[model samples]
Target chain A: MPFQPGCRRLMLQIDILLSALANGLMTGAVYALIALGLTLVYGVLHVINFAHGATLTAAMFAVWAAHDGLGIDPYVAILILTPLFFALGYALQRFVIGPASHGSDSNILLVTLGLSIVIENALLAAFRSDTRSIDVPYGFSVIELGNLFLPLPKVIAFFASFLVAALLWGLMAHTDIGKAIRAVSREKTGAALSGIPVEHVYAVTFGLGAACLAVAACLLMPTFLVNPRVGNAFVLVAFTIVVLGGMGSVPGALIGGLIIGVVESLSGLYFGESLGQIGIFLIFILVLLVRPAGLFGARA
Target chain B: MTGSARLPILIAVIVLALLPLGATSNTLLNFMTFALIVALAAQGWNLLGGYGGQFSFGHAAFFGTGAYAMGLLQVRFGLNPWAAMPVAMLLGAAVGWAIGFLAFRARLRGAYFALVTLAFAEVFRILANAWAFTGAAAGLLVPLKLQAANMQFEDKRLFYWLVLAFVAGALVLTAELARSRFGARLVALRENEDAARALGVDTLRVKLAAITLSAGVTAAAGGLYAQKSLYLDAAIAYGPWISVDALLAPIVGGLGTVFGPLIGALALLGLGELSKMALGNLFGGAVPGIDLIVFGILLILAVAFAPRGLLGLFDRLIRRPRPAEGGEATP
Candidate 1:
């Protein structure tokens, strides 16, 4: 039997909207995870880690290496890789970032930018610019709910993002080390005076930030392809998210990411892919113009 | 400004001007032409990023706009390249002013301002990629017209001379600006905007003017680049790589210095070519990213060791003797 044409069109429109919303939420979760790491480091160190995306790319490469070479699952690789990355981040802060901290803001910015270029180009040299992806058992699996379908990998990534966020919240709220980090972020001199080991906290906070990237990379491996320039593709979006979410605010990152994800997905559906980016940038410019402090940022 | 300071620059310019006379290699001339064009763009960037202290991460917008303006006019409208060049530069300045005005009015500073510029560039890139008039991802190609008025030449030597003239003009302009009251105001703003404001500096107007001038000059370079390459694509014109190149040269040499961009362009491009050669020799094949790795390492070292750049080191060396001379006079 032929259905009513108008009714069928309406149903299809609803389905499209629902799908876009669902995808937006999932993508937003990943964006939030990435931005959270950036915000954490920014909040504590007062330095924008321009290499945040590069670190994410490095972590993704690490996951791929373990999975491809050792036949380890990506999830399992996360457990091993996260700690290693944390140590690497710790060392980076202690050595490279520590010295530059005394310089001007531009100095720090340029140093991080240079580091990003180094990591990205090093990866390009090593990997030869080929796009790689992991194939988990559930990579293509999907869940059906009424008129909606959800990709399993995205679902897993979404939940993983939340799980990590929750863990970070718990760590920050309850742990002694977390308190020290908070103290340092609030006032380095005061934290030092109070015997909180401010320098140590800075290193550890940066390490934690890198560890978050490791988790994000592990979660993203099943859904996104990895390449030397993949970080470049996402870095701008992460910056947008951080700015939208009030720079260093943890909850703000989550909210900002979701908003950007929805805007991107909806615009993509309506206009096309490239214009979707324009849409996000439009929003970014608007945010900068209207409220440079961001929605959740503390008033200066 | 001083005779001592001007002497080396004069000597360098003379050497560069006479280089093509002895050299017969089209390859070398072409390389120098590209470097000089980049130097021109970098000089423009230096006006804003170094002197005005507004580090733009999205100069590609102005560049791409200029390239596209020239390409579209020449291809679609059948306009003369000479006519298109100024219009394109004006368009670039307009866009720069718009972005600068919005950012400055909002009082965005440092990283926030940088990111806003990046956003504008990305917006342009996306538009160029998606718009049919821009030929989408296929890009627009300039017709192969070997005419001076068209800004195209049969010989690379002509292009080299053309680009060298522009680079020299930029250098002279920058030098003049450096010694001017406007330049002093810009430097004051860079040192401390609040303090500059307290001293009655029209911070916003100075910044806008600097950025507009910077964008206009960069756009002119972009127009020449399009004519030379005969192609206008989003990636080539508006890519982040272009912005990086523009800023990198000034940073590597010495931000806010008149001769910095020229020295930086020579250093960066020369190093890039040398590294490519070295890597090709070692690997026995073309490795695509070795130059970038070299550049990255160099930039890191530059930032870490010489935050003020190579010219800073030279300044110290030059002034060392002056202090010694003063001590001798005192004794």
Candidate 2:
């Protein structure tokens, strides 16, 4: 009550900025989760996985089906869907992508592109391309701090991203499968010579990547809607994050995700929503041209 | 048939040219015109992606650039379509050169190159959608002028014939390029960039030239599209679908062949029709997804079973597999 009116106005602007930043970080956390899958697939496969967005969309639909068709809670659906998608991802790589590509980099690119087309249309055909969202009890509930309101599900997603990242880090750093995956990523021929089951490791990595999508979809479905093409909105941003973080660096993705989220949020605040997309793409081009190795990636 | 690219292209062109005499349906004419437009765009892709070995996933940048030019010049400046088409093509080539300069200078290749091009296309799309001069989201429409001078014909078959002429010229140019010294240099870089550089080829220059030419041809296709459709929108001009269609025809028909995009475009459209007929019922009739689903499957199958495409398959069926050491490695 005793505050100067001008100072109060400045304080309110700061609060709005802070709120946008918080919202961005939340969206970015999910983006990181999405990018983690992309980066992991790239590490071993050595090709950009075009099917990633469709896979996320597929997983989101799976989550939606669990909620609407089977009457399972979205959060609980995550536990069931993650492993199921891991298997789907594994089989897709082993049976479809790997065999079809025959180890050519260009061929793999086409195959993945084709996979995206198939997966997106399959979802379209199955779901009829309508956008749907779950009606969670707390969907409109928010945590209020001063004038700022943070949605409950988004806050949960922000924290869940860290937990997922930590778990993924532990797996990559400590587990034998992780080691094999890394070894294969570093050098397929060398890994093969060193008694690693190269093909199996590739499949496992793909499975892990898909598992990440399932987790992300489950987390996102609460705050985000599902449609045949919903993942596309996130995919470009994820690609930007993956590139910014270094192509294969998990930590880079996490940090990059947050940075991009903030940038996107601030830009959207200033430039309006649609035109704000230019900011992310400009950042992407700058990073790619100026420091393509990204902040964390090993120099190619 | 065996040695001359000209012979096959000529025969194909003659057959296409004669189609108007036998078929009088407007739907067929419209369909043929659209297929030719796609084939032109695919030929553009074939130059850089197939022959030069640079796979650009965002060719829409060039296509949309050209389309926008054609749209703005004709609609805003009231220029003739013939004049606008070349200007649109030059603009597209300029965009290609600028992108190539930055991307190649940075030594980006493979997936990096693909993604960057995609980003550029999206950027152009965003700008186009926002700018009032480009008609913004309401889209730019070419006035319905039915005069031959406007490049729009009262008779739909005339438009079909005109497009066939353009496609025929593109095919001949592509065939000529395939046998040229510059073409050999492109193939050299494609096969082994480091080795080509080591052998004194200016790899950067070759890539830039290929991309510029590629974009120009693709832009011409875009110009042709604008004239035919008589309307342009952000989605139709700069969307990823054109980029995909541009590349798909070449990859499916034959990657490095002069005739690939034309053949691929026809076959692909044919396949779409076949799938619509066969699988439309499987998914409940009239769903749009069935044709694309078939396309995706066909793309995978093409890469797996016939990497060189239909022409290559024909080559294999007619002749013995070349003994590795002494045979020419030409596509």
Candidate 3:
């Protein structure tokens, strides 16, 4: 209990723990953003879009291409890419995805998986296997809090994540399109009977889902390298978070992502880096076993 | 459909079985041998994914378990591959039974089930890698032999023959299974689970049987692969690519069909090889991503256009010559 060398070590440990937790939270925000799109589409359409991560990858690539090939900043790329992504999602849902959704849930699963493979390989061919990253003007800058060190870009990314998630929540909760989307998410038949164009709602829902990636890709751009197969890791983690947060529960996804992120970071810091993945998976299994409905998900 | 249509298929199998006898090229023999093993693995997967309606993305765990079993036994105990192979099958079955119990007991279906299986395989890979006895990521290598029963061969023809025998055995067993009463229950469960359960079907038992048998077959293939390559490593034995191949073969060939797995393996393996040839060094030098790109595009086109797979398209072409029978062949 008295101040000693051991106590000093303990203090250092605490400092390390806090910093890891902060790092985890920032990464978790990005996870939630990516997962929110997947959960939304799944909640409405009852189909897990395996291609969701590929969409994120595509967005990252688009940003990289714009910045590197066409001389556009990442922030500017977001504005330009957002509309393109929305249109891409809208057209995809209406044409390719809509036809595949024939009341059988497996159809979409198969289609999306196929689409993911396509996107990954297409990007691989176009970009090669080399890793690419955006040169953020202030990428190396970090802020310190006592013994805790925080990277500025990560902090910015986290704040941007919060902003986007909040805007999405507001749009879903307060707007007319949001109401229709929510209704469609709950019950397509009922929503259709109520004179809402369910098809249009599906398109908009898909667009909104794709739009979530715009924010996530931008945030991820600073800290991580983007490659064709980069989506592989994100896809698995996003699914785990979605499952943890409760499938189709927006709030659950946000919270679930944060929990996983913190847990993963702490596990990496305390245990080993390899062990972190195991902890995340254990959490996944535990959540599935204890609460199939997820941490914040409403029971169907 | 009657069993009469199987005659042509039987003949096709017979021709494939004899293919290595006259083949002089070692490369051709190796390619054929690889294709046969892959085809066998795909058929093993077809039992669960196509017939049992349980899509597993972690069959590689069983394959790896079997491979490691053989490798470790031979390396540690100096046992013959002939002895080690049955042990591998048994070990593979046990692993299958354990994972199947954990997963199926929970009634995790669809994509959720698939992800759980993927997790299981990853766990297996991690554990295998950490354990020094299994040689970790560098992989486990079996001592080479020049005998038949030991499963070592100086001639590619002999390896081809062994692969052919195993593949044929798998196909016949799968066909026999389809005719079995349990297989009927499995089909019923696959078509309509609730209805099958209502009709006194023990869905769990049916699924377990399918899983165990599938795992055993996959393990046997793994054992053969260990002997053929004279090496077994985590990456090759328990790789994610194995799962991808397993899933892709059944889906791209024809789900629940007898010849589907074989056809899928041939087409995809050919495509894979072709992609590597075209994109392996296509740029100033060979680029790494072109094959994946080609593969992805092909898959998207396949899923979008021919979800039922190549067999479905073949059936359409064949049936077109005859009068339209209400277009029942259309997926």
Candidate 4:
């Protein structure tokens, strides 16, 4: 039975509960997008991409530049920035990280770490550590569901995540390049022997990952503010999601992100915001300690 | 340990000791003081990463623990700073042992171990930032009492000599480890854990011991930092910046060697000051991050071009190849 909003105080808890879940879902969608990119790269490269946060920061800056300088809407800027970021990611992996690493795991790790340091410091130098956001017309708009109101930008991001994930799934399932990517990630030597230009496939995978980050950055700019350090917070959460989702599993990432999001939202409701961040790390540590394979364990 | 092999370390320490007598510029003293502190921290890292081949990504966990212990014991409980320093190292060992036990028991190695350690450091940072016992976000500051007993000195050179003493001690310890039976087992495990285990090495015990000692050594550096700076914050103590520094020094100097951290710290931080000066001149003011950008480039270049670090490069330049001794300083 539906209770009247103005009539009863008992319904307030229920309202808060529902609201937290709704916010969790909305936030989870963005996390899913971020983790998807990380998972894809981890799947193919077999090395953690230490520069993932810096790359996201760069994409956020691009969106901010397009809006603040050129007057393009954040959503409209996504179309231009996604492909641009794709090319940038492709070039970075194809030229810098590839040759520098020389196919060694430890070398790759160091090179990526170095790359992150460079990118982050460069952003700090250029941006002066200022928080940036797009002042959209619809930034304040909200949709009312019963007694709960959800912000419209979050609502848009939630659905956009579904669309992107579906499109990515279709691409992986049906496209020739996608087949090559899967083959390469599964067996590099075999894929190369089977005439799949392995290096090209690696570059393509990196590009797609960066494209995902661009879409995520665009969706985020309307509601969230950007600074050089902001992406670092998300990077840790995204890593937790990847771990929970079983490293390289796409569906696992989406579901794991939603679970973590709900957990984070509820913990924030209970604990103070700063301390609540610890909940994510606790869950991550527990997952690593208790079940290294993860609950999903689909493709671990 | 052979006296001839330890000849270089002796000369280096003596040179460092005499440096203040010859040229006591405050800038140079400040740089050397900070560099030696980093070298101590890097020595802690090299014990596990370079010797045991663990490659941790969250050494800040140990460093911060040490710093916080020094702060809380002094500020809250009114413990003497001298006593608090050792306590910090003890706590660091306990923390390291706990993490090592859980991780090694689970058989997590390589990247997984690194990730877990990183997560642990984040947990500590968040707790320290928010918890009241550690003074919350305002951070803890040591009492500004100028006395040798309190480990504070007005002259600054006394503190420099004190840090060099600690660094010298760490160098001797590392040099001793190169010839010790424990170091042999550690290097054996690094080469191949399965082979070492088959050859009767207690792999788990050795790793745990290495991590515990590593944490203690690193914590000592943290304690010294708190004493020298007279302040400690969650970010300052527990940040990823320190963790990177702890790793970078040994790699740039010469991995698994006694003097790697000291040489690496001086070279790296020296380059850092050079960049800062250049950028300051160019921009006409203090500008952040130009040096770090240079550091990042150097890290990549070092990995790609000189895997054995500056010491190895020097060795090549001099064309002096030492005999293959036990526990050669190479991965």
Candidate 5:
């Protein structure tokens, strides 16, 4: 049973790679979901929506508190929270965010950044800086498929990402409201002149975007340890994904999301832990160079 | 010069210059130095973000690169501080030139450009954490003694004067830039890119110039910051806090105006110190992430109510007449 040094080294390398990939995918799926909302808002509004990450974290906290404090299941909490988040999103867009949108892109960006700060800090103040995690009854369960093992929570998160992305795609491609959104995205005054309720579309866009976070939050609860600062990790990756997927391109978000997930996964595995984020950012820069419009982005 | 127009500027400069003399403690003086460096950073940021209209969310890259350039030269190569700073600026300018070339070439304007820059900063941070020469996660610490030319001074007042001098230099430089042909081109590009391009303005060249200069100024601040803090690390250099500080100053004061970043820095830094003082009392333990919240809220309010910034608000309160009203209108 004596093993050669080279063989042993190769075995260790494989193990590290697998672990890094596993972590990257698990985290990247959640990142994709967050970016999907951001991408959606951008697709319609051409605004960065810095609040996207904060909203996701806030919702994750909401789900965590509901499940932990109130003894409600995270899955069930989503149904209760989706509507509430939508309304909040609607009000935020209609009253405060939309008015700021009238100026340059910088104006919109600053407003969202501000909103994110408010949400994040308020969460920090209320929840304190301690990390929060919900213990799903079956959170740790994993299925063994040959050489790889997939955790139950990650699978759930992946599936949630798929479902939400699919639904968003459907809404944009197959629905009347989606058409209005697309119309508005093309030309605002033109869309308005054609009797499209521009304001309603903007509200709905933000609401749906926030609603995506609601689903992401629920899926995220059992897996990632929720913290006031969790949004910081997600923001950069989400931004990269949105850019890669094309600013407002919907299907691009899905494709961009998956590509990032895989890259994140593989990079972590091949490289050390520290190189994981740097690896993703390199991909982001490369993609920007190779395809300015994103992988599947429509030509500007 | 009109007394009304020049009065506020004069008063503000006088107040800032006298700040260190009145301060008794090193802590407060240190804070003022920190604020001044950040204000310098904001001014640098203003060149790209405010005037050029290329909002960058990730300026920490330049800051970190400058610090590291100097740090690496000093520790690894044993170069003098005076020799290292200019070298750092040159290196910083090169990196800025590269990033700007790539991003601008891709037509990554506005939010996308901002994101790319931010991502670049994150990359630098991760690299800083991984790289061996900079001590990886432990960070690179440059030794400091009472060497004036080394940019290290035992006296807080001396350090304060150095930072104040840098601030004045930045202000004069920015003022000069704002009046230059390149500055006019920047404004034209900002106001109407298509029109500027049509007018045969080399838009990309103008942006590159602004960005390179911005990076140089920011790098100088980073060098001074490394000396003053006596600790240069990836987190301190490339942290989101640095970016936020850079962003907030210009917004609070005014984005494009010459004195905006300074005014913004003074206001935001004062409020931030005050808030910490007030909140530190209410909460016994370390109150983490509260400043971030305040920064975010301030950004929102600035964008929503006064996109033009505090300078704009001040102008409004004083009811200053426009050049049109002063018989400068044509046609």
Candidate 6:
């Protein structure tokens, strides 16, 4: 009977590990989606979009608003919000970011940082710091795969993110606009010389990045709470993933995201939540120290 | 260093020192003290961020370290505030040196460097929140004792004067550093790291020194802040808001200039207070995030119209009639 308790404890441990892994994968998929947006913008702009997280938070609020106001499904809100965010991104890049871009890198950094503060505070002013979340019909439904449990919302988010990633990959590989964006990213002057309209490409690329955030917000809203400062939590993780994935590499973002997710889950399980952040940050520093170019990044 | 410059700064300092004699309101004294403390920290930030061109997004780490050092020493070990401050500053310098070493050795540049610094602060924050020695988010409170040696004063005016001394020291140090050989090397490294390295500038050493000095000064300010507020917590000390205040001041005033942080701090703190009061009156209570909204707009406008800050704008205006002496026009 005493030995039986030991056996049960081992089984419980295994189950916990498996569950953490599963949960991490789901969360990592979303992280990859966010990091992909960041990496894409960095690839073209050569300026870190400090407001990337704020943009995601803004979109999440829009999704929440649509769901509450019109009874629109969170899934459908993605379609509406994506286009809206894309246009917003286009205008932002064209009018605001474009003008600021003329300055040094630090200038652009300040500009974006300022924009992030503006967006975050504006949201706070409007929303009154209340946490908001959308309820889906199948929000609480869970699927039992043997002893492991999979929440339906998380599974949907994971799959949706995966699908979008695949679609983005395909678009980048097989589309004319994608090629132009890549061209501009590779060589702005060269792209312009080739009559690629680099500025327009920059706007379009930024829009796509923002649209990716919209998709992520849609997937995330079913499970996570939305707030003005919600993006602050995710932004650093996204940065870690982007750096790990080799700033401009799509596949790298996915791998980095998954690694960070697993790290977060495992650390959270063993060392607690705050230490998990410390663990991730340590890994980030280690990666920067050992491999500044990143695992999949081309040498700068 | 120049007579004209020396005269104006001396007069300004004299005026600020004498103003409290006429207006002895606690509110004004408190505001001035806070602004001066911020100015001290901002000047520290300006050394590394503006002059060195190493934008640290996680300066909260050093600031927090200083506060925690002061808090921990005074609260836990019963160390005197006067002695604890220099120790806190040394701790800050050590932390800065360690961070700078790792980052520079890894050859992390630009945004990567910024991110690493941010991560350091975040890690420090998490640790501070989790550790019982830090009082675990409950925070450590300094015992209220009106002793000069304890660095606590019953009168807000005393605190104001104390902070003014530190701010003046920082301004002097910054002005001196701006003309030093080490400062030139830092600026050189900032402009072109590889070129500087090739020129035997010891770029890493220069950067490390700058960061260490910057961190030390920032920590000193943090110590004063802890003494002033008589409190130290993860959020209060290590939060992003602290770092934002440090960087924003120099950016709004004029990066790479000794007086920039002072001007920026006054403008920022002034505007913040004014807006807070106005918004409070309009809304019948303090609106939580209005200050940040105003700050963001101002930052955006500053970047757009005056990237060199108010000082740079003044320089441009003053030199407009004598275009020949304007030298290299700012981009």
- Model 6: docking quality category: medium
Candidate with maximal DockQ: 6
TM-score of the B chain in model 4? 0.94
Q: Candidate 4 chain B: minimum summed lDDT over ten consecutive residues — where?
A: B322-331
Tell me, by lDDT, which candidate is best. Answer: 2
- Each prediction's TM-score versus the true structure: 0.95, 0.97, 0.93, 0.95, 0.91, 0.97
| Candidate 6 residue pairs in clash (backbone atoms < 3 Å) | none
Candidate 6 Cα outliers beyond 4 Å, as residue runs: A1-4, B1-5, B321-331
**Cα deviation of B303, candidate 5, in Å:** 1.4
lDDT at position B180, candidate 4? 90
- Model 6 lDDT tens row, A148-198: 999998899889988999999888889999899888888988999999988
TM-score of chain A of each: 0.96, 0.96, 0.95, 0.96, 0.89, 0.97
lDDT of each: 0.86, 0.90, 0.81, 0.88, 0.81, 0.88
Off by over 4 Å in 1: A1-5, B1-9, B318-331
Docking quality (DockQ) for each candidate: 0.54, 0.64, 0.50, 0.59, 0.56, 0.70
Where is the poorest 10-residue window by lDDT in model 4 chain A?
A1-10
Q: List model 6 lDDT by residue over B115-156, tens digit each.
A: 899889988998898899999979888889997767887677
**Model 6 Cα displacement at B215 (Å)?**
0.3
- What is the C-alpha lDDT profile of model 3 across B126-244, one tens digit per residue? 77887789997777877766888677877778778777878878887878788889889999999889899999999988888888988988888788788888787777888877777
**Model 2, C-alpha of A297: deviation from truth (Å):** 1.6
Q: On lDDT, who's better, 4 or 5?
A: 4
Q: Looking at model 6 chain A, which ten-residue stretch has the lowest summed lDDT?
A: A100-109
Lowest summed lDDT window (length 10), candidate 6 chain B: B321-330
